[model samples]
Target chain A: MDSRKKEGQMKTNDILEKKSTRRSFMKKLSIAAAAGSAGLVTGGCVGGSGSTEEMGLKWEEYFKKNYRMMTDKEKDETVARLEKLAKLQDDANIQMSNQEPREKVLFGYAFNISRCKGYMDCVEACVQENNLDRNSKTQYIRIFEMDSGQQDPTSGDGKYHHEVPVENKYYMGIQCFHCENAPCIKACPTKATWREPDGIVVVDYDWCIGCRYCMAACPFWGRRFNWGEPEVPKEELNPKQHYLGNRKRMKGVMEKCTFCVQRTRQGKLPACAEACPTGSRVFGNLLDPDSEIRYVLKHKKVFRFKEELGTDPKFWYFMD
Target chain B: MKKIFLRSGLFCLCFVPGAVFLAGLPAMASGGGVMERIHHAEEPYDSMAIETAYQQPVKTVRAKESWQGGTFRVLTRKDSITRFRCSVCHTDKKVLVKDGALFTHDDIVMNHGKGENGLVCIQCHDEDNRDFLSDSSGKKIDFDHSYQLCGQCHFRQKRDWLGGAHGKRDAYWAGERVVRNCTSCHSPHSPAFKTKMPETYSLPLDQ
Candidate 1:
């Protein structure tokens, strides 16, 4: 862990060096442009009287290094900038977390197929907790209502609107599995997505180049791309945010479930698990032999979704 | 010769279960059931075997039932109950709702058991002592620990709940292993869940 952090610092220094060189070049260009367009500059200065601070913050954010490559100081600065931006735009005070994953803790999930009654309480909780885009209806978790004979979740219907737990049917939820050998990481051209030490696969949203390659490469259909500006109502916004998990995203970037890193990193259950009315979901440290997840894995007749794909997903499904 | 024989015996004893344990792991990872083998290789069922390992401190109430072995903490129940202290109205006598004498529990419809001869209020509730519930043998049980009454017939769910597979747990995963009691999700009178519309449904194209 120490060596990995050191490597991150070294990479950050390299990026900082490059950023300074780029900054000088941009500065020269801006100076030349300003000199060339003196009349326009005076008009812009007059027109943008109270917006210089916001522009400066945006400029710094554009030049910020990737989350994984940032030093402690840089991380703090970025978080503060985001908080300031939130206050400026929405007038909503939000606390964004950059809490690192805990040691010796590999988070895993277990879903009891028989128990889920298809009420979709978890879907509601996840959308609210993550401050998902309201207009587009971006949801991290999808509960599929599977027929009695069919075991495959993909074959089931996720758009069922009528009264749920329809006779002769069961429900199974699917989300980002946070696979051990995540193909999305390999597909990323910019190294935006990577698995943390504690087994959570997270995307550094700023670094994602809107390529959508990770989305294509993911077998589980786990990644979601922002085609337009993601919007959340001011009152419904989840003020507690995480850099890699649930922080607001701009247009053209990709986002997925991060197991509620903002909450889970603080030892809380993911919002979906906590909101499950039927007690179908279980989340815990896989490393802990005595965890409820471990107990389920040990005793229950369990199977991973798409185990044949060799993704080695941390999520499992079991029947009572 | 004696020492060699003892070493061989010890190795055989250790290696047999160790081999079985290692074999069970891949089966678990691959999503296969080798439960019969696991039972043979490990110690007998102990409900309290799992230990709590959390970074943050958690608030929990100790379960009072012997089936739980007091291994885990359950979330506090009494505070959440809307009409606690059943003895408030029935002081020392059976208080029956005659006609329309301002009934407090008029909306409670008992749909728990099957058929016309299904579970009645007196079967689970003590008429003489409204403060407590009665089990099959008519043992007085506090309302807070109502699982003891529910578990009498639904032993399978009780077992799964004890093993952490059937019931809902507290918000935090790491902290003191606190779990919700049976009554938290299920109404004691009508345990079965009613069908309801989903809170939010995503676009079909998004899937």
Candidate 2:
């Protein structure tokens, strides 16, 4: 009878040991999952949970101030954080423009409204060029076709589709005018929106406090604010990047047309101008009287948008 | 002495009317005629404006000296008046017999009447519609000879022409192909190209 009791006791002990082993395995798995999620959030392998306020403190601080006032160390840290956030959103490789002083490179664009055919080729090109987040709202250029004999540019319709050479319609493509005297720049108390020396107006994604003052100030209605994390696929991301232009902006920042400064600064034309079949969008030195813009102004009866307003817009239009 | 007095009286009568016309005043047609009919419909000042605006310059060719080799052309006042009249191109004196005949052209004539009765060059070739060119040899060339010259007045049509969206060309895909001039579809004198549509020639699809 003692021998029988001893055997039963041995079986019970085996069952208990197996149960203990299963519990330990489950605990390890839970810990590993928690560690992975924390890594994704912090970009570090160390596992821990932090409150939203604690996690976003650095980003919030960076966003609160102007980029011009940021120290060299702060700027580097901000850029690094942005890069990490971009990578976390998409595993795709990102190449950021290493241009220093980042403020001096100004870019500008002038489109000939007379030549635009409402082809939407530039719209498609921008989507591919910037690797826009497909799920969210993003549009680089909005072309509106006004009725014949109508002087008001705002009187046109936006949706159009068909073959080339659509008649009796005057197409006005509205994008970032990158004005020399941008009201948005003046309105931004934080100086988030500033003009570069090359004539491109840009927004510091990290420095923008989401005040939306720039959006209100823009006369052309060119600014777009990201409401959520931009969801872009990794493969389609453009590795060629620029600091002031399309380097994959973050959530809650205001963005607008930069005249494709990244490409223009590198001696290349804007992607929209390149994709245009009719060569409507003319990009060149406004300072150079010998440029195509100069020829257009000299030969054609060029008119600007709201000329009475004296915005001194670089964009010019003439009858074809 | 009697003959000289009569000539002087006639000269005075003509001079007074001519002076009035030059001073931005419409010349009163003798016996209340067609000029009066048209003038009555328009404002008096506007009629004068139109008459003054329509005044033409005379053409004169001066004989050149032996050293100069070529004669220089200058316009005289009487010649300018004649050039301004419809008789400049339609030299047939009978055609300009009626005073109102100078203003008639194919597009302007309201009534067709009988065959070719309404056709006139002045009808279509108004100040806004006139487009002409002079060749190197001093020959007046029509729109057919130079399409671009015709485009100056017709800005919208010219744009289509340059973009290859209007006018007929030799091929579809190949860009390097001969294209027809404006005169192929339009006559400068008539300027009503649409009138020749369908009846004169059908498009390729219609054919």
Candidate 3:
């Protein structure tokens, strides 16, 4: 009821925002006209009828409220819009959802450095499972092959092109740590990035501006800026998507791993964890005492990559 | 008006089921002769062995299933164990395989553990039981129950497995916990993992 009242007030504010959005919309339309697409608007003739390309980029797209503060109705509208946009652009039937996290389940992940063979299967699994931007090769997972007796992960080469499980050396993978005290959340000016109840930090993609503040703030180089419209082959596209997670990302937005929110929320393992052939990646609910992640933290000598920064990363690393 | 419709629908629905139930009430209360016969056939035997509920492995992937492609899978112990049953060759006098008995497996190179020289096939595979494996305690365990035999030696790994630290748990995380046996990854004959290129998606250029 409170949100509905707030939304009503926002609807009044939307008219104020629309006047400004109209100026930008005019500029974009003029640019479209110069590019020989003048027929799109002029041919419509009638009001709000059959304005092909112009109708898709209406004033509502610009005036939509920030996701976190939006009402449930607004969220549903946003999800529907995103699904329609995906179908129009990619010809892919994507399910963009606003799925809530499982109750009492705070996710934690741990990987054994010793066990990782630099197989990079996790990276592949993450790409396919998440439906990440293929054209930009935007991989959220990066496995670092650290030299033997070297503790520094930054020095480790992620670009190594050799047969792995190198003798005397070990491999360590890094992704969005989903920190409890996340810096990316602080850097997102629009309140687009926020940690879910399950400790998986997610981005409201529609709300995010082109500003790369979150990418700049992230210590582990976790975030990826989409340079152009992310190109995923229609055949290879993963239909299962979450609006705040792995839905088809638009251009000029910063994206990172959400620990496979669509899968994890439904009592399934993260793609990377499921694909680890070495049994190195362990994932479970941190709130559940009997969970594997808790066992790893309690029993194993686990440490986060950037422990000094005090990000309090939910993800951990250990050597067995 | 809504209440009237709901009430009429409920009344109709209740009568439909109630009428059918009333018609069958006498027959059900009297009981079927077939059920009585089935109850009588269920004999109680105090001397009968109390067999445990069989734990069927519902997982698709197993240790043996992921082993090899064409010839290697056929030649592996999983197939040979069933084909050339140990009891077929090893009778009254024979305890283990002699020279030519294992000559078919000339390509076999045992390099699993450091104590491979002292180890014989019968130590892990039960000499008496043809179909089952045995732990150090001489417990007759089914082939599916390889974890019991494996847990005897690799206690730390076993502990981790039980704690959900080591080994792969299949499909989903929340439901029934179904994990892989030791053989799902490690080869019984030669346990070392072969080094190779990663899957195509994670190549340097792709990154």
Q: After best superposition, candidate 2 residue A164: deviation in angstroms?
A: 4.5
> What fraction of native interface contacts does model 2 preserve?
0.00
- How displaced is residue A149 in candidate 3, in Å? 2.3
TM-score for the A-chain in each candidate structure: 0.87, 0.74, 0.82
Residue B93 deviation, candidate 2, in Å? 64
Best by TM-score: 1
- The per-prediction i-RMS, to one decimal, reads 7.6, 32.7, 18.7
RMSD of 3: 19.2
Who wins the DockQ comparison?
Answer: 1
Q: lDDT, candidate 2, residue A90?
A: 51
Model 1 chain A poorest ten-residue lDDT run: A1-10
Instruction: Summarize candidate 2's per-residue lDDT along A173-283 as a digit string, tens digits.
Output: 777777655678768865577755445678887667888898887777778778887766677777777767788777888887777766665545577776765556666
- Please give the CA lDDT of all the candidate structures: 0.78, 0.53, 0.69
- For model 1 chain B, the run of ten residues with the poorest summed lDDT: B31-40
Among residues 3 or more apart in sequence or in different chains, the pairs in candidate 3 whose N, CA or C atoms overlap within 3 Å are B63-B184
Best by lDDT: 1
Distance from true location, Cα of A258 in model 2, Å: 0.3
Q: Who is ahead in DockQ, 2 or 3?
A: 3
What's the C-alpha lDDT at position B180 in model 2? 36
Candidate 1 residues A211-282, lDDT tens each? Answer: 999998888888888888999988899999998888989899999999999988887889999998899999
